[model samples]
Target: MSANKKKNLNSMEEDPTADDSDSSSEDDDDDEPHPDAYTGNEEVEIDFEGRAPTDPDCHGISQLLQRVFLRAPINTMQMADMIIAQNYVGSVICQCEPDGAESDMDDDMVEEGTIFGITTVINMTAKKDIACIEQLRGYIIQRAEKNAPDSVLTHLRDVLGNEGRPVGFLINERFINIPAQISVPLLENLHKEVLTAKQKGMQFNFSYFIMIVKFYRKEARKGKPAEDTYTNAEEEVICSKAVNSFEYSVADECDVGMSGDWLEGDATLTPYRKIILLDAKDLPHLIDDIRNYISGV
Candidate 1:
């Protein structure tokens, strides 16, 4: 990745946590609940609601996608709209409103909803004609061709190019600090939603799943070489659940987020993107693994 792109990605990824920390320090010094106070640690009832994306959600969805795509030249707004239009798949994470809350708030007075996380699947084979989908497909293929080994490259081509076997691009994104516990319900619900959609004759009958997962490569330590670590640690469960899978690193073309302060001693961190291809049948197993991993089983 170019230096500018790396800088941009790092800024986007780190700014939220930095701002949160600042807000927390300020909140701790005061006894009052300020408008901008951080209450992330407080116990509150939240819901993993399944809802279709609407016009108002386009901006938030696009913002979440920016972290995934980095500085890639994909029209995330259009991609968000596509996800919204599909409507049959995906779920959004939101804080539940208390019962007996007044419904008289004006549109302008109401705050813009926060989309804590989203997990969904997009039909890459069936929706290849869409502009943003086409862009995403071309981008993935380009990166794989440039960085992946010949074996992985051949496998990717066979899977994505096969007309009879549809593939789903699984999207799992959230704020960097969102707890893994949230992922368990989100993924479990996604599996159920996908099954329900298929039962209703929707086009969610995917044969293979393609995931572009984020991870960090801890720089070499002592005599040991660099090793990969999951950015979302829970995703390690998904990797373990895959039976027939192919993975390749695309860190060369992607941005590597900040590393200096987050490291210790001489060791540094290099952010990377890994493309994983797995059978769709493993979705249930993956969900189980995530639940077990998060629950510390």
Candidate 2:
């Protein structure tokens, strides 16, 4: 990773809660109602005996309330006025889209690394916390789509099966920082685990990953010296600037490998978005001396 890329990661990964705390507090305070104001808890009689016809468009609570409010001694407008007189607000609540349905679907699509209608799972062992892993998965997908459009995401799936279970590595919240330390193992272990499976007659679409996540320092000046010095004290995990998808697997380099045959030019140093592609050599070195290499990056 370049210095600028690391800076960008820092900005993205910076702890959101740490910045300009007073300004955020003020924004929260602005949304609150006056302390002296009180919302009424008094309940109105439904007046079922004086029920009125329901509107065709009305549904659920609205339909039930229509029977009472439309014909009751007090109409809807009158009820609204009463609430306003008490310094309270009212809104006609309506059903919205099913909660979290769209978000869940998007998360699934990302976690599966679905691209060009193909789905690949990265690590089989990393599925303990479905929600957290899904979140990280979604983040990776969005970043890849935005940054690594032309790059091919090296797709790999467990040969055992791809149903009713997680197929990718467990991604934790801590991946935002110390990327090389935490993430390199994920890719390394993934290759080893799946290769072992392949030796046992397990088949997969693709294999191996040369992935590294690195973070760097950034500084800015705000005119005043005191305000000018800004460091990423709150580490934030941001999208990788360099993402390269390859068709090569490190396992293929092994002569005795059962699944893949060695092929030259299989690995392409393609840039993801404008970010430079990671070198094939970088993968092994980072795995071997991740702390030292990340520090130098």
- Cα-based lDDT at residue 199, candidate 1: 97
Each candidate's root-mean-square deviation in Å? 9.7, 25.0
| lDDT of each residue in 139-160, candidate 2, tens digit only | 3444445544443432322211
Clash-forming residue pairs, model 2:
13-236, 13-237, 14-236, 123-168, 123-169, 126-170, 176-237
Among the numbered candidates, top lDDT falls to 1
Per-model lDDT: 0.63, 0.25
In candidate 2, which residue ranges exceed 4 Å CA deviation?
1-120, 123-180, 205-286, 289-291, 295-297
60-111 in candidate 1: lDDT tens per residue? 7786776677777899899888888866577655434434754443122224
Candidate 1 residue-pair clash tally: 0
Score residue 265 of candidate 1 by CA lDDT: 17
Question: TM-score winner among the candidates?
Answer: 1
Clash totals in order: 0, 7
